[model samples]
Target: MDTLSALISHAEPKANLFFSGNLCGSSSSTDHPAGGILHLVRTGEMLLFEEYGLTHRITEPTLIIYPKGKAHRLQPQTLDGCDVVCANLTFKDSPLYRALPDAIVLPLNELDNLSDTINMLFIEAFTSRFAQVAIISTLLDLLLLLVLRHLVENRICQEGVLSALSDHKLSKAIEIIHKQIDYPWSIDELANKVGMSRARFAALFNQTIGQPPLSYVTEARLLLAKKLLLKGEPIKSVSLEVGYSGSVAFSRAFQRQFGITPRAWYLKQH
Candidate 1:
């Protein structure tokens, strides 16, 4: 699988449509902890207020992405208000969430590839059609994917996993890591696969991804183990599935990373 595909295959984002209409007044994100918040402005103008006293006056059609759990607000610039379709986006345990900026503002016209999808979404959101809600929900999910693609292709992220995926050589290594996470991968082998010397590849990966390759592998394995364990898989099976030699080693690593034992973590969740 390709880098972006592998990345998404491991963690696909979900969107829950919460509001769709003209905003004559203001709206604040009271939902304290969401993976992200998305807004597509179909018409008119509005002012975006973000944390740290940042503000942006948005005109024309635009896409706003708040990719972290940061507070934000929106108010109309005119009495006519702005027509918008908004959703709460959730990317549970996704590395992309940490790589994304506090907020992203992109003019709709700039995203030519999304024009058709955006139009269809606006029509469905405003019309009273059969399964309108369902259709809109699906469209929002698609939009989120497209936005991620845009970010990667455009090199919107300067650092972190997303940025690393944008690099041709690093992306190859990342794809292999995600696709065969259960394999016993070594740094030298990863570098050879990507045609880079061990030192160069290690340095580049660390520079771009902000972590050593092996450290990233451990993180990915543990995250997958966490998911499997949550599904009621036995600890032994989960450990082996994520490339651990035994449950004891996996438990030690899990506790070191999460500050609790695997059983204790799962029990707390239950």
Candidate 2:
């Protein structure tokens, strides 16, 4: 697993279809919750407005992703019409979620490699046959994955965890940490895994990821522990699951990381 794959695995993103239909001689505003939003245009044209100003003239088979869930307005350019499918993505908290931009627009030309997937989405949206919901749901999920791949391949994102994953050597180390959160890891061990000296690896990892290797590992472990705790796992089990030798040590670290005992945190969640 590379950094992108690890983050995606941890986030466990789910895409839910929100709306699919034609728009003509009308305008609509969509306010999305705190997640990602995707809009795929199958026909005609529309104008997207951000901050009450025209942002992009969405024509052709285009896909737009608002990774931060920024609210925007969309209106058909003419009475001739526009056909679109929109979906909302809910993701568990992860650095990849924060790495995405406010919005990304990929037109037909840019989505040439995904022509088949795009065509299928349009077909499913219009057919309205049996199991259409299930089919569309799967296609939307596929589309989101493709979008993430495209973003990384095109180097469109320049900051946050995604940017760090762009580095080949650093990505390898990140993958190891994510896959083996229960392992007793140290800066020297991580450095050796990536074939770098401790000092050099520390410098490069810090420079690229904005944190030291050990610090990143600690954060990753705590994140996994929190997720397990939220799932109603026992405190002792969660502690060992995240590499702590005992609950007392884990509790102290957890308090330092989150300012509350694991049991208290779990109670609040309930």
TM-score of each: 0.95, 0.89
Model 1, residue 211: distance off in Å is 0.6
lDDT of each: 0.87, 0.81
Per-residue lDDT of model 2, residues 148-184, tens digit only? 8878877788765677677887888888988898899
lDDT of 1 by residue, 9-81 (tens): 6676788888898989888887433557888998998888877654888889999988675688888989999
Q: Which TM-score value belongs to model 1? A: 0.95
Runs in model 1 deviating more than 4 A are: 31-33
Clash pairs (backbone) in predicted model 2:
none
Instruction: Give lDDT for model 2.
Output: 0.81
Clashes of each: 0, 0
What is the alpha-carbon lDDT of model 1 when measured against the actual structure? 0.87
Candidate maximizing lDDT? 1
Candidate 2, residue 73: lDDT: 76
What CA RMSD would you report for each candidate?
A: 1.5, 2.3
